[model samples]
Target: MKSGEWDRGRFVGVELQGKTLGVIGFGKIGRHVAHMGSGLGLEILAFDPFLAPHMAEELGVELVADLGDLASRCDYLTVHVPKTEGTSALIGADVLSRAREGLRVINCARGGIVDEAALLEAIESGRVAGAALDVFEEEPPTNRELVDHPAVVVTPHLGASTREAQVNVAVSAAQLVVDYLQHGKLHSPVNAVFLEPDLRERLDPYGELGRRLGCLHAQFLEGNPKRIIVKYFGDIFDEPQSRNFVTAKVLAGFLGDRCSQPVNQVNARSLARDQGLAVEEASEGRSRYFANMIRVELTDSSGERNLGGSIRGRKGIRLVSLDNYHFDAVLEGQMVISANEDRPGMIGTIGQVLSSHEMNISSMSLGRDRSGGTALSVINLDAPEIEKLAAVAEDLMQEEGILWARCLQAD
Candidate 1:
């Protein structure tokens, strides 16, 4: 119409009815899409690691066990997962190649979920019919080829740009503020808020410790988390609210900046459970080396990671044990932890590597199981870029005697 050509043939599109719509990351938005697609007579197949099978059956949706399987079956695919390490480039070349011919992709979720390059290649190769993207790997995307493609539709990340959305967001914000002020209730808080002043005072330090430990654990985490077991040792278990509060903080920290929504102490447990993560808590009155200790064991598909911490007299919070290796390392700022063979030159080797990169070590803690065996080293660095710290860890691993190294930026 704009060109005054009136080419009716060019405007013809395929009907969505009776087509299989694959919903990846079946969270709230994905579920809504599935519901609407079902209304349109489309068969909905959802793939979410966290979603329960019964819930899918109840909604008249088939639960797909694998992403590849969903891709192979669906005529159209839409992603709705958070962009974390596991989800980044989820719909890459391999997944797209496995998808049914003429599969149309849609992404209104986060950027980087569907690999742009792969999608572009797929569209050009006729593997994918087209793509409807509301998000991109980069905002104001530089990929002009994809943007200019006649078969593709692009939006400037405006999924929540409606007038109703604007009004609802404003109302929600005002309501949250009012509720907090009048009723002392928080609906969605970015930070942890303790209602009772006395409780906050008593548990603030331990909560911080728990959060730090969680953060550290998250940095070391591999694969999808299945369960979080929090064990409280010593006098900290005396307070009735201690167990719940600290556990929440731990979950909050572990999930920091990983979830689609902001996670806080109030909603952390629920959010974890929603993602199919089982949360377990245990308490003991007896002391284990410290007056109070919060031990968290995160079990994931890869394996289990154990992290234990305690609030020392004046040290504030210290990470006491990691995977059974005992050491007193302050859980703050930029730090590098490594497992290596017990030797005289191991510490010096790490120091030399850091020195080569102009990275200064502020503090260092070393722990070993036996006189001549595997050892763990936790080194605090004077603020380096996270990327640089990761690079240093990689470099450390390449050195002699070092088995593995990991960088942690704990807040």
Candidate 2:
């Protein structure tokens, strides 16, 4: 009409009301489009293999098992799924051939999901009426035939090009990077780690404790970590979804010393993958000791070591178990852990060594199954300004009963 080329009957447009609108991926954006389309009286149908049937029902959208079923029933087909190996050319010649006659297609998603060549053929053959594409297989698309096609409507991929949307995307990307860099957080990670919204809030504290355990384990172990196993026990494992966040946190802590770059939940698993290290996770109904436990085992060339912790009722995070010994101590501030034989005067000897170095002991915890057997001592220090605490740890290791000692700082 703008060019005075209007052919009243030839350029007829159809109303959207009562027409079926098929959405391929019902994630964040797809659901939004479905809601808006439904408001305009268009019947909504969708296909997402991972989507629960009840969720689709709640959205007033009928869920279809496959793309073929969606194509045969809808007047308009829209692609919103991510471009992956399985989704490249997801709607190809076969899908377009089986689609409802004169079907109009829309792709506001990533490029290459719909085969442009097939779309062109469908349009020319009158199997497809027209298409509205905001994206293309190539930017500044070189194919003039499709770009100039009278039946197709094209735009310079402007799905989120509006000023507000661009600003929002920029801010979100920057924030995710900053959060991961400074505080080891990824609000929405783009990896295998998935933490449900409801579970994240409930499991955050445990995640922190799990990371601390990983950090401690890495510091205590002598050689490079070749494999790690994170085990969840008791009520926490019952939730199932809690493990992902816990595993990511454990990895973040374990890799903290291994990487020069910032280690956080987002890149932790990826970093581990790059190093060719093996990570395994398991959950059991109960722990042999604590009701709820997060245990992390590290295996290096020398041998394997276990470090476990649990959250006590309202008292916050505790160092529940270290190797075979068990005790409850706050997991914070400067502390020293020692593996030693249980014997008289061992505690006094450790305190004497700290006093000799002018270091103050704030609190102390000792755990052992039997007297004169193996034992672990965790001594919280009040001397926060001591930079060379390792020298003092070396001094403690020289004592008669003490086997090994290491200094640690936790928060």
Candidate 3:
């Protein structure tokens, strides 16, 4: 796996919308599963007998009148209902027998949902279209029969592995329900959070911003945010000072966004509160980083997400902090800057390349390295002429025998 990659399966198609996605449990992940399903246009129907019908509607989910009906109608079935004494073989041959043909199944919630031996038989017999598993009833001693099956995609319980995913689950579970609640949007009822719409409206505009900031906090916050105090400081607050309240909301928004949950301010806070978190507020204070910063108190699930960044040149948000060190986060666009073997002017060659392409340097930052062999120069640009920029950077990295490029996608 890569820096942020986890074992979900060999990356394949994830389009889920428009299909009938039947969720067995309809719990936290199940609701999230449904939310993902809806995003891919899936018509969600959940089976959680313990929850009320109206509640399912509130989360944008439909509660099946019966489990068999859900099984019969769904094109894809994802088991979310946890394993219990009565449900040992919940997805045995009997259950699969009821499902329509070509029924794709996923079991990331827990392993016991599908009887291992039964699952293998179904897969071998072509009763299942495709299968995905993240857990096994017995962890290491997996069902070798199913493990070796190609259509039976398997992962070592990775539904809760990503740094971002774990952080969201922890924080969302800790937030105060009233501050900023989130839930399934009447499509898949799961954990429900109720909040005041006025605060929700106030918190909406900062959704993405809050999400990024919270992610930064999650990736960087040194401890578990089990008990956090969100504060709404500075000019952004109206007469209402929601320093802690808004900050907490941002954290929830961050959790909700990254996990692809149907997040809303209304439920963000409540989700935290339900998880037994101690949330507080600050009347007055100043952040050390940005002009106005929201400070978060967090505990690391593992070691901690070491993170820091700054607004670069002008509006460019560049990350400057990672782990214990701080450096300007700069990836040059076109042109050249070099950490050469300190000959006369390694910088001169880079300049020549820029001059020939008519590309101007927008901004640059250098990091400390060896006295003669290395230096890091990060440059900025005015225009992004793809061919000109890539050629220069590629040529420079190759000539220097360095791998100097990365691509990114935003959600």
Candidate 4:
């Protein structure tokens, strides 16, 4: 004990082998950290308001309902959440003050998620044993005293600076470009909003449905459009990410049909704006027909029209409603659609035309309000020639019973 710097007789340290680790956010990075801690024989507990219960169980973590419960039980705590209004100063004086003594905290997520002043108070008052801060409220922090504190360890924000991480990021960026250029696949998007993996999976079908819906409307219009409004119903309204995906696809379909140049999800919005077309969105959770649905309404000099679609369990993407007529038909392949009077021989007349042209009917569905009112007939065909389908539609429109007819080919 010559220098007297080391307390040789009273040495103490917290072992992580059997201790509890509390994770604030169960995002990608948080899950990785939890896996590492689990491998080290540490019990992992997590609190994420958005994370589902099954996800935590799958990660072998106990999901805590409250922050205070997690703070009081953990020997060590770490935060991994984005910097948002809801998460600003998430772990503050109150959380630290209520924490059990000898608790060590780590903040490597964002600067403002943890209050530095409250952390210093906890350290000084012995409420916290130590803190490892990789980020500060201010970069090159003005408060040097806190950084120099004996119980605190600081890093220069090099969290994602590893060589492997750099390579991954560069590859991801290049892949995003290649995906867009080569396949029109938007894997990694900049303008597209972020969504949880589960939510994305659930909403994938709707994106396709939205594109087809828009295409159907555009084909039906065959003229200049004044305005387009997209409506979301049921749980789809809760997810903001779905808005971008659906709207982008809708624009892609509509513009791709009308524009001479190729239109995709990335460039659809700009194209819509350049064409002096008004784009709007609305959402309502209430739906009398289905749990979730997307409707696209188009207004032009001619009139107003609406097309609606939804994802049904095993049925896949279905065109649920077109204007006042409601029908369930898969929006795929070559389709000949006709709006006509609810005549008894309407289906026979359409079938006779296809039979005479040697075009096989893949599937056909008819929808109408009543036996004597207006009706809609969607006939999927093996017919590929646009002229042949157009001839059939033209023939139907010329008939006394048919009001309007259109040929839509899906590419």
**How many clashes does each candidate structure show, in the order listed?**
0, 0, 53, 0
Report lDDT (Cα) of residue 17, candidate 1.
83
Best by lDDT: 1
Q: Show where candidate 1 strays beyond 4 Å.
A: 1-26, 34-77, 82-105, 111-129, 136-146, 161-198
The full ranking of all candidates by TM-score, starting with the best, is: 1, 2, 4, 3
TM-score of each: 0.76, 0.52, 0.39, 0.52
Candidate 1 lDDT, 1-411, residue by residue in tens: 887887899788899888999998776788788889988999989887555455566677887877888899999999888887668899999998898999999999889999999999999899899999999989998868888999899999999999999999999999989999999987766555444786677688988888888888777875557788999888756665778888888987887756678777678888887766788998866765888888899887678999989987844889889887999988899988999999889888999999988998898998989888999999899998766877898899899899999888878
Sliding window of 10 residues with minimal summed lDDT for model 3 = 402-411
CA lDDT, every model vs. true structure: 0.84, 0.81, 0.57, 0.80
Per-residue lDDT tens digits for candidate 4, residues 1-411, read: 777677767667667899999998776678889999999999999986444455556667888877888899999999987775457889999889889788999999889889998888899999899999999899989888779998889999989989999999999899889988999988534455566787777877887888888877767763346689999998765766678778888887776534434566566766676554678988877689999899999886467999999888933888888888899877888898888889788788877777877889888888998879999998888756765877887777777788888888653
For 37-87, candidate 3 gives per-residue lDDT tens digits of 788888988876434344565688777756667778988988865564335
Put the candidates in lDDT order, highest first: 1, 2, 4, 3
lDDT at 138 for candidate 3? 90
Query: RMSD per prediction, one decimal?
Result: 4.8, 19.8, 18.3, 21.9
Tell me the tens digit of each residue's lDDT in model 2 across 1-411. Answer: 899886788867899998999998776678889989989999999886544455566677887876887889999999877775457899899999888997999998878989999999999999889999989999989987788999889999988788999899899899889998999975655444566776666677888898889878767766445778898987866765578678888887776644435656567766676554678988866988777889888876557888888887743878888777888877888899887888888888988998898888888888987878888889899855655688888999899999989899765
Residue 90, candidate 3: alpha-carbon lDDT:
79
Candidate 3 global lDDT? 0.57
Off by over 4 Å in 3: 1-15, 165-411
